[model samples]
Target: MAGEVPAAAAAASATLLALELAWSPSTLTDADIEVLVVQGLLLEKAISGWRSYFGEASPSEDWTATVVFRSFYEKGFGLPSGAFFWGLLHYYGLEATHLKPNSITQIATFIHLCKGFLGIAPHFNLWRALYHLRAYPSKGTPDVVGGAAFSLHRGGKYPEAIFKDSNKRWAEEWFVVANPTPGLLPRTGLPPVVNARWEEKPTEEEMVEVQVLLAELQKHKAEKLTGATVALSFAKWLTQPI
Candidate 1:
């Protein structure tokens, strides 16, 4: 009888601790959010330990803590990080099977982050990050969410068709479709018909659109790009003569 009472008291203590640790996004401080992430990791580790220590329980699917932490991270931070979601998936013991909704969301957020919120162009680093998210997926990769990883990453809200569009691939397809040779300069001395686009300038609306895009990207998705890539790709092209 005494032992039963002690067990009940332990249960009560656990309940109280859980309630205390519970998170409400509105009340979360940076420090508290950090704590929540750590605690979520600890729970994941606990499940791992149980599997290793006793082999008495199946792999843990106790994603309660992970789910809670993700809710906080997504709401408080407003931008999703692949690493963060991967941590949550680990906590849930779900190996990110298939083109899971979260996987699509993370990759889309990744591209959107790189585009300064324009949501175009596939940056290698962004692709690398997505690769990392899917790296050790539990059940191997199920079919991609949509045809492209990024669109599906955003809960199918985005359509990735543009990425593969022949027109959008103009920069590359230009060489194949419309090769601009020196136009056979000959004794006839006709000027070469260089089909280059020469634009005048922009208006206030264009300027505002650009500025707003930049600001929105920074606010919702962290932009971590610079011109270094352009120079690097250019340098490589120069060396390779491509």
Candidate 2:
């Protein structure tokens, strides 16, 4: 029975790793899997804490150990190892040693984590924020803010008509563009010079304003669920009336 358990876990773990690799090239890393293994061993210690209270046998009614075990199992599965050893122990209702770390799982997990961290994997929130800002600059924003809020309802047409010259235009020869605000055009005239501040870093007031804006944005996003499909949500947002 013991031998069969490990074999089953190994098979399941391989299957999970294959599916993950097929769906997305990046998901887990070697270092992450090592952490999960250590976490699994630590999870086993919780059982001993309960055992000491109720003698050699842990009481069947104690649920704390079960929850901790599940957390460890989930962490293993999340790393693409299928949490095989965790599953085997859970099935037998016993605490057993963690499976030795496999290089394949570690390598695959590392690749996955790298891709996600580098933004290669589809990052919906980033895209959504960009879309929202471009689509509606004036809505739900501070009164002092000013920029192009051109309507994009027309299909395959520029937001500003090609011949419209009402807005002042600036020649690239006059000034060089630095790190300006994204999605906004440069001013038509020379930049204004301001007196230097007492401190080199941003003032506490500036930090407070940034925090206020972040809090507002968080509140706006609270209505939406992060688990929703990004592609589908984006398609819907693109087609919906602005």
Candidate 3:
């Protein structure tokens, strides 16, 4: 029974990874996909074992969110927070007005989407202030925050129409063009700046905000369900109109 449990969990993890990769914005090679599957399986086993050992007294939601956000901040290397935020908003057709701090479940959903799907660290405090969640501002643009690894080109260069029609191919092309030492630069040229803050660390304010958000989520939970149930609730909440 114990051995079968591990095998079943591994199979489930692989299935989930496959489903997620199908919707990934960037195309991944077979080798990369295999690597992700292996990693996902390992993560699943570790988390499952840890939860089993803890049993009814698992870590608090705030602790889990903090660790997850901090790990992403430490490891993420591609897109900066602002660029990822821009892409997330554009892809989801979400405006700044939709991101309310008090909407704990929705906010948690966005955090998960930003990290899991967008492959970027969620800058909680920055986003909250940018969207004026807690009396920050009525309207603010992501461009003003800076630290972007690349920016969308202006004018007819890399027109929105091209990307709109191109699908994932455009994402692939952007990566190829964005390469610092591409053999041949596109007609639009490379991104103007490449401030890849690989060593950047999370600020105290950001960690505090994460704690606050998780605490709110904890309060919103009506029962003592597993993290998976909470995650499912967040996912369902995402489908409803704002």
What TM-score would each prediction reach against the true structure?
A: 0.18, 0.15, 0.21
Q: In candidate 3, which residue ranges exceed 4 Å CA deviation? A: 1-108, 111-123, 126-201, 220-222, 225-227, 230-242
Clash-forming residue pairs, model 2: 26-112, 27-112, 28-109, 28-110, 29-109, 29-110
User: Per-residue lDDT tens digits of candidate 1, residues 1-242?
Assistant: 87999999999898655533321222323343345336442223233221121211111223221122222222121212244444433332232222233343344344444443445553432232123322222223222111112222232222222222222211111000011122111111111111111111234555554454445444433344322332233234322111
lDDT of each: 0.29, 0.26, 0.30
Cα shift from native, residue 193, model 3 (Å) = 13
In candidate 3 the C-alpha lDDT for residue 107 amounts to 36
How do the candidates rank by lDDT, highest first?
A: 3, 1, 2
Query: Once superposed on the true structure, which residue ranges of model 2 sit more than 4 Å away at CA?
Result: 1-203, 227-232, 239-242
> Once model 3 is optimally superposed onto the true structure by TM-score, how far is the C-alpha of residue 169 displaced, in angstroms?
17
Q: State the lDDT of candidate 3 residue by residue for 1-242, as single tens digits.
A: 87999999999898655533322133333343234225431122233211111112111222122101111211221111244444443433333222222222333444554454334466544343223211112122221111122122222111021111212232221111111221111221111121222112236767576555445444434334333343354445333111
Per-candidate count of clashing residue pairs (backbone under 3 Å) = 5, 6, 0
lDDT comparison, 1 vs 2, better candidate: 1
Give candidate 1's total backbone clashes: 5
